[model samples]
Target: MDTLLSAPILFFMLGSIIALAGARIPFPEGFDKALAAYLLVAIGLKGGVALTTADTATVLPLLLTAGLISLLMPLLGFALLRSAVGLDRVNAAAVAAHYGSVSLVTFVTATKVLESSGVPFGGHMVAALAIMEGPAIITGLLLAGATGVTAVAAGAGGGTMSMPIDDGRDEGRDEERGGSLREAVREAAFNGSVLLLAGSLLVGLVIGKPGLEKLSGLFVAPWDGALSLFLLGMGYLATSRLREAASLSARLIAFGLVMPLLGAVIGLAAASALGLGLGDAVLMVTLCASASYIAVPAALRHALPTADPGLSLPLCLGISFPFNILVGIPLYVAMSRALLG
Candidate 1:
């Protein structure tokens, strides 16, 4: 409970409350993007510095395990959505992609919790994070294709299939050309967020501790404050989109709450099987449990155009994101301690 009441969380709640009450908070333009970039760069640098001392043998296996988890999570999520929640193919695949990916903000928050608790984790977890980002996107795309939901329109009509005609002759020409998939894959792999994180990680690895020490004043000192502000923005975004969430069915809402728990269970199993310690286990659980609000949304906008952003965004950003931060993080930590100890 004390952990839940921490400053970052409180700021997030305050922002949500203010937004829900229809109060206007004047945030400077591009401030949110700036905060995100700063946080990612800081985290990548810290991870790289930590990697300098990490054991390669352990890191390799953990990275592979995290990647495998990322690939499989969407498959599980898609199946559950289709069989249990009864979401259509496009919506199911789109939502599945989100669950399969990790939220950088949530991962950062978990790191802070671990740090405050005096828990030690590997720097290579960042590699795991980067690796986990793309596979689920691919998997979701494949699922959509297999179900013939690709090229659907991006509206609230729920997976109605339609293709735009260029001069009435290009109808089905775009589909035949297979251009959209290529674009989505490129976006998923080379998206600004992924590139910055991966590049920063590499830079950190090359520079090691000396580089980190030199840049610590900028990246390290102001991390928590930046995160609080970013999360405050997140709070406002989530509540503003809360109306969209009402369009989702009861079953889909239940899936939003349930998927994180399931992911955590899968994470615990993986961590235990790999003999991870307390902090790493918690972080692993967090990676598995946290759904992407940033990367996947952008990719899906291009990839699954017909997959309603209205549905997936609200479920992920508004519902799952908050649940994981407020309730899921502590729960995963407790589970990690009990198991890892």
Candidate 2:
């Protein structure tokens, strides 16, 4: 309970309440972005340092497993959204992409919980994070193509059209379609977050523990404070968009809540099979269960423009993000302890 009431979570709540009450808190422009960059780099460097001492035999298998989970998660999400929830191809794929990708904030929060509880985890998990970032996006794009929803140039009116994949209007849009696919892949693999996180991990790996110790004053000491500020911004952004989410169908909202639970179950089974320790298992489950709000959204907006951000963004940022933080983390931790015992 004390863990639940930590400063970061409280700041998040405070931000949400203030936003809900229509109070204006002036955060400087680009402050959020800078904070995000700092957190990613710090996490990466920490993970890289940890990776130096991690048993390669164990870490290698976990990376492969995490990558497999990342690849398959979107397929499951897409199938469920299409068959059960009755979402059309484009929206379903878009939502599935978000589900397949991991949320950095959720992972950071879970790590905090693990640390508070005195459970140790491997730094290779950061590598797992970087690895898991891209596969689902590619999967979403492939699913979109399979459904025949190709990206075309905007109409002369500067308005966007939500056209089906098989629509006959795609006669001469080959160049545009190819460009979008390339762009999506680029965004998914090399976005600011992924690059910084991956780069920091490599830096940590090369520098090892001595480097981390020397730099702890900058990266380690202020981590919690940075996280609290970031989540405060997140809380404001998440709740401010609730009005848009209100338009989503009950079925979609249900999927947002339910998918995380399903993912957690799969993550637990996989981690247990791989013989992960309790703390690692909890982090794995949390990663599997959380959905991306930051990186994937930007990719989708550019790559799959016809896919409504209104539908996918709210479900991820508003519903799943909060649910995972408040409820899912504790549940996964309890499950991990029970299973590992």
Among these predictions, the greatest TM-score belongs to 2
Residues 1-341 of candidate 1 have per-residue lDDT tens digits of 87677778888898899898999668999988999999889999989888989998899999999988998899999999999999888779889999999999889889988877788998889889998998888888878766533375446343456433235645454573266567677888998999999889998999999989898889988888988898898888878777678888899999999999999999999999998888889999999999998788888776677787787889988789888888999999999988878
Q: Give the C-alpha miss distance for residue 293 in model 2, angstroms.
A: 1.5
Which number leads on lDDT?
2
**Weakest lDDT window of 10 consecutive positions for candidate 2:** 152-161
Report the lDDT tens digits of candidate 2 across residue range 1-341: 86679888888898889899998668899999899999999999999999988998999999999888988899999999999899988779889999999999999999988888789998988898898888888888778766555664354212255555555656545555567678888998889899999999999999999989999999999999999999898888888776677888899889999999999999999889999998889999999999988788878777777787788889998888888988899999988888986
For model 2, the stretches where C-alpha displacement exceeds 4 angstroms are 155-179
Instruction: Please give each candidate's TM-score.
Output: 0.92, 0.94
Cα TM-score of candidate 1: 0.92
For candidate 2, the TM-score is: 0.94
